[model samples]
Target: MSAQRKLSSIGGGQKTHQFVDDSNRFEELMRLGHSDVQIRVVKYGEESSGRRPLVILNSIDFPMPPSEQFCDRMWRARFRVVFIERPGFGTSTPLPGVLLQSETIRNGAASMAEAAILQEVFRRLALEDFVLLGMGSANSVCYRLAMICPMVALAIFSNAVFNQNILDVFRPNWFQAMLRQTIQSRAGLQIASFGVKYRLRRNPEGFYGQVLQKSAGDLGYLQNNLADFERGAELFQGIEAQTIEYDLNMSLKPDSLLKDGLFETTNAVAFSGLETTDHWKSQLNQEAKRLSIDVEYAPNGDLYAPYASPEFLLKVITDRLNRLGAAQSG
Candidate 1:
């Protein structure tokens, strides 16, 4: 059976498109390049909102920071948000065969396959046009999708990864190699799972603190909004051990989407933090220059700007969408 027909039956059309409780979101499978990738989609807000749907591209860590809160924030602004789970993240199927194959993961083939999957998603959802929101490493995927899927009317980026080489400069060279090997073996998965349990569930605060050190105030903010963290962690529930390995693997790969002039022809908006880690500064600037992206830097924002300054992020998004809508009508 074709993937579209299979998904239609699963969603039952009406049930598939209706607004559901947070816990009742639906997951469907789509065939992409010899692998069956899982995609869980949710439509937020009343259908009558008349706003273009928002499709969010998740990061390398796979839907980082839980999206329930983010979705709520968008929905409240009358935008319907679709949270896409990239292949190898959450319930999605991992790449077929050993993911550690340097040629496949580092060459850009994996990213191309992922972009094809996004194209299929646009067709299956019957999306005529929508806003594209790319978070973290997912920004690369979003950029690739925009190139292939014309249905994406606008693209929004948040702390995106334009050049992996810049990011690699900050990483401990040994750790990257070790992580790749660990994700390719069964025994390694078991060990990684044990580590994830301790970090994500047993002591999430400690885990988050280390990652949010540049945004210490944001970490404290998360402490008060722990529910968002808990929900974001759900994206990695069963796959934490594999997610890091896969994300890093992709990071090492060449990015065709970040090439010069890629975003010049597209309508896009970008946001980053003046307070972000020193490592990301050069990368952000280079990416912005390549596409002529005017980045809106937030004083109190960092990598966690999506969660730390939801109001600011939402305002920028909402205002841009409004402009797009008005332009379409005019």
Candidate 2:
């Protein structure tokens, strides 16, 4: 790992978060245009010439730490794993003002601008030619990045969200509108932030349990990994709530790519669990058909598998990477 990168508070009077860790995983805040983005980067095993670096873009609201065991597996497989907290989450600076635009065309342009921010992040880090992994709504941005950026050679989506319907189904239109309003209103944002902190603190178990139940994952896992889960939540301290809201709002929009040549320029994979809704599965299959990409299904895992069952998620990614390695060697 590179030398520890120093972090400073972004705005005057804003609270700062200190992230010192024993695992040698470094977290840094870097300026990107008018916003500051937080990135957590870790490398396992030896850096070999044979494998490509892997970048994992987590969900908008989750700044969850990368799975250590999964990272170890990637190392043994010859890949370096990087977990990044997207803007408006963790310690990353959020865009100023209400992000909801007046028109659909303008919303699409905003989505493109967000993808461009990822490109800028790569340039700032001097990173290139890496495989991109995105989970849930984050995959939407990854798809856009892989389509437009030459350095993204492979794009992987796990329990990917491809349409506005997914978000609408998960949370009704009225609820989303309420969230948008709370995120934009200062007093509302503080109250909402306080509610999040209170639940995560007072009922971390019940809190994470509700999340795990969505996929029917084992809640016992959360019990066993309580400390890790708490640590991951700690990373969210002092993060900009508006950024999380921004991504959430953006996620409710349609896919960023034109349907014609979705994954044409990049090798793609969809890793999902058996419990995924039939409608989502059908949509994913259709998108995969369009891109000529296969969906790799894990028998007992679901959308939140990466957090709930890291081993299952790791296997899915490794299987694809192994196939690519074999084909290249042949």
Candidate 3:
């Protein structure tokens, strides 16, 4: 994604900046004796460590390389960026090999543990008052984080919804169907992260065409993202006869508590793309309004629009934060 295409490593170190968001601003955080199971983290600028700063979790397993290509400009601005890889994907280890935790207990524990570790990222980094950006799948993670962590200053969610609220004509059932296929095909999903190879699986030409398009067609952003999500265990359903399990067996506990508990300290901004389903567009507006957070819209597709329209988002967020600043000052 970098114009360089191939970046020589700065040192024979893990901290090379291949395509860091705000490329000039980030350095890979050394393991520092922490378990590798802890997700990878990179600071936005060459700042002293031990600051909390704004912690951002990309949706699900989205790669920093590509996101950097698309949205690095935005990430470089306003706030320091902290990128986290969720458990089961990216640099984070999928629950310990030992299944002693049980599917349910382990799932719940991991999310909490992940949140707790994130707080550590803040404390260890020495920054205070965090912000969150959960695009697509990460929206759920952000939602969970807001409920679990009181220190989060703001939460930004894009192209993500709960419980299939938007089943509009703009939606793509076949896209999810493909995920179902990937979930079912043990061989298919393991290689999802492989990108080009996975693109060739069904239609190489068409897939690559979409990637270069920078936005999805009528199928929209979610479809393109589902396509881009180059990683995951073979769709669990791909391995099993049943359909994909939307089990947030890990999510229900925290999410339930969030729904029940009154959320304070954290403010929010919900963004949706016009190309998205009417249901998605409406649902996000209503929810954000109800939650008392600001809501914004993008004319672009779901995936890249948050990225594509970063300027617009920044304006909305900046204006809101300024008002917030004024209220505090007064």
Candidate 1 lDDT, 1-330, residue by residue in tens: 011212244222221333233442333444433334455554444445676688776775435333456656766676667667676676566555554355655666666777886777677667767888787767766767777788988787877766635534322343344444554664665565566555667666665565566675466566776665565566566655545555655554456556677677777877776666566777777768876776777666565676567677777776776787898899
**Range of the 10 consecutive residues with the lowest summed lDDT in candidate 3:** 236-245
lDDT of 2 by residue, 54-124 (tens): 78887754565455655666656667776666655555554444543434323565556667877877765
- Give the local distance difference test score of model 1: 0.61
Show the colliding residue pairs in model 1: 65-232, 66-232
Ranking by lDDT: 1, 2, 3
Which sections of candidate 2 miss by over 4 Å? Answer: 1-20, 31-51, 98-106, 167-198, 216-221, 234-241, 256-261, 290-292, 307-330
Report RMSD (Å) for each prediction in the order shown: 5.9, 5.6, 7.1
Q: What's the TM-score of each model vs. the native?
A: 0.74, 0.73, 0.65
TM-score of 3: 0.65
lDDT of 3 by residue, 141-209 (tens): 566677666677667776655434442322234334444444344344344324333444555445534
